[model samples]
Target: MYRQLHNLLLAAVLEGQLPAGTKLPASRLLARELGIARNTVIEVYENLRAQGCVEGRHGSGTYIADLSVDHIIEVPRPVEAMPARPTISHIAPALSQRGQSLIAGAGFSRRQWGAFMPGVPDVREFPARVWTRLQNRHWRKAAPERLSYAPEGGLPALRQALAEYLRSARSVRCEPEQIIITTGIHQSIDLTTRLLADPGDSVWLENPCYWGLRSTLQSLGMVLQPLPVDAEGLDWLAAGTRPAPRFVIATPSHQYPLGMVMSLARRQALLEYCRLNGSWIIEDDYDSEFRYGTRPIASLQGLDTNELVIYIGSFSKTLFPGLRLGYLVAPPQLAGAFSKGSAELYREGQLQQQAVLADFITDGHLTAHIRRMRGLYSRRRQCLLEAVQAEFGEQFEVIGNNAGLHLVVRLPDRVDDVAVAEAALRHGVLVRPLSRYYHQSVAGQRGLLLGYACVTEAEITPAFAVLAGVLRKFVKATSA
Candidate 1:
């Protein structure tokens, strides 16, 4: 009440509605009239008087201050009163072009956690108590060095822990010295792109790839050549004769959105291609470790004898998205440069959290957690698949490897997947239109990417019921 009155009276004074020397009503009288407590009115007057917007005589009621009060109280201006364009708009900025494109693009959904939200793990299943204990232990012994900026990319202990985990789990041939901790895939991409390539350099990306990867490459002004993926996944030889790209970004462990594993033959061909062309391969091993039937495929980096692959891994899928802790395995020669470059570029530090993560991993909590989540997510995935099958019956074809957080349900060519996604959103079920991931339109591949990882098994069927209603509305002839 006091704040409301203060703002109202202050604005009245600043706009000159209440002229100088205009005596205000008594606190008791104004309070009664406004149906507020007398204290509320008194606090407003005291605050205004302190700011010199009002003055109170010993015996007289408060009055709006003299016109000189204008010198102190700034008048609020309407948003439209400002200039038509920002000052930076006066210059030709390449960043502005990218910024505008990003604004126009499909980004991480506004509602981050919910049914069928892609790329987010079930954070509730994380061993929070264990992490909290580790975090508390770090704070109890609070080392100043640990709290300071991570001068060598990240905490050494965390890097070492990650190195061991990746080596055994993903078959990544990396030493502790080769690991440079990063904020996540985006930062890893940014750091590598900055270090390795100049503007206007060519970057080959998988069509219908992770949207973040596409956005990052586009922002860097790299000429993106999107190669369509098939069952074998992003085959470089299929691209035929063309100028060798400076970088090739591949998600060989499990192709994103579509979820196809790159064949060993294709993986070998890609590595050989990059090695021959002196290009770099950014192998985004985002979430292949959660395979249902068999062990996750070995990383593409494990085969890179020529130091061509930059293996990027993230805790976002395995742990929780909020952790934002990821690591890049740089080639041995560039490891030191990446560490130094990271410090100068980002000045990133959350060393205490990194220390906690290190303790968690080394204590075997991370491994236990991953093992538990694999089972939980696998069950949840089955629940969603069953619901999708029950609702759509074989009318909608669900593609992608039987792995990862999400599944792509292919729509009929004539139906609009975007409309289905939008309508599902209106009914409070989140989905990503598969077409959004493609650089070029493929009407036949129109589908919705449904994430099943974060959603509870019980909620999956109910959510899909709602989504199925939306889909049937958009996908005519399947309306029943």
Candidate 2:
């Protein structure tokens, strides 16, 4: 009878029904669901586990192993051979001082016409009913202290769920103890900055980066070293002569605003550089889930061997921003410090929200929702790309449309991006200027960073029409 279940699972794998690295149902739960003995399920699991069909970690649950022939594939070609990175003898401190006011307000409050607001999920597409159901079920089973102060490391169940999700989706290797949940990316960055960086440490950031990162770091009074980002992504060598940077904040999967994937070679170089310098790397994996091409690129944290990388992620991009749940995956060394800081200062996350998230992850709602949204966003990305080609012709170049909510559109050299963005805003189309993402020193990039995930297909045509008018006005104004 135990062999019966093992054969059933093996057949699912052979037929591609289970897919590689899929999490299997917990033994006890599966037994209950199938009306079988617990030991029978256990025997089945042990057999498959011995055969290498599945793996179970202490505290973490079991997962089916990938038996692909090319499991140990070689790294892809180097984007460009990085020059020997400069060694740091002196402690290069981060230059940007946390600004006079430490607390910065970050929430979506702006409303405008033809809004191509990036980094926002389509709230209407959210599975609210399923979420509500999980919330209801979890509420009934809540602990007596559910409303009281919780652990600073975050709810155990939510961390477990996140650990499992990251393992399958991003290939991130970590346990629940490594996970620290925050209110959003802003909070995660703040917490990490507080943990790893000093008041005046030098930090490396990608040019045309996420404004939120710049605002957050600068507000913390950390010196930001901006590196130019190209089609391949951040120029790893551009950190400039430094008191070696204390941290390199990067969105390697799909760079913020630029939308370019940081190549594998650069990621390795970054890891190596951080290792040698004793500097930490913050892998801000903002929007890698919605790739239109092959499987999403594995995360940078997946490749870190030096324990120098800290991973940050948010569900606000995948789910709704209202959820305000983001997390940090810290190195073992920072784990205790972070826990202490969170406990003494921030405390833990909300019990009800974390409980609902746990249910959402364990019961397979998140996996199902991601599958559904991946298809939806893939279509929307295609539609937007098509619209760009149809309306603007091949003359207007688009960059970074492969995997993210937004991409940078470089207009003709004569056109002024700032003027165009201003004109577009007047027409009720709110596209952001690419220069806004860059620091004041390098703010002349003539492009618009347009985001499409939150915008509907029905809204696309008019949005583009307004954008085209704005572009035309820019051309006219430049010629005049």
- Give the count of colliding residue pairs in each prediction: 0, 17
| Tens-digit lDDT string for candidate 2 (1-480) | 777888999899878898877988888899999999999988888888898788887787888888775674565756999655455652233222333233332322266323587767778899999988888887888787778887878888899999999988998978888898888788889988987788788898898777788878887768888889886788968655566689988898888877778888888888998888888999998778888868888999999988888899999878888888888898887787876776666776488898898888889988788778888877777777888888778877888788867767887667767777777877788788776567778755778878787888888877887788778767777788
Model 1 ranges off by over 4 Å: 1-95, 440-444, 477-480
TM-score of each: 0.82, 0.76
The parts of candidate 2 lying over 4 Å away from their true place are 1-109, 112-114
Q: In candidate 1, list every pair of residues with a backbone clash.
A: none
lDDT of each: 0.87, 0.80
Task: State the number of backbone clashes in model 2.
Answer: 17
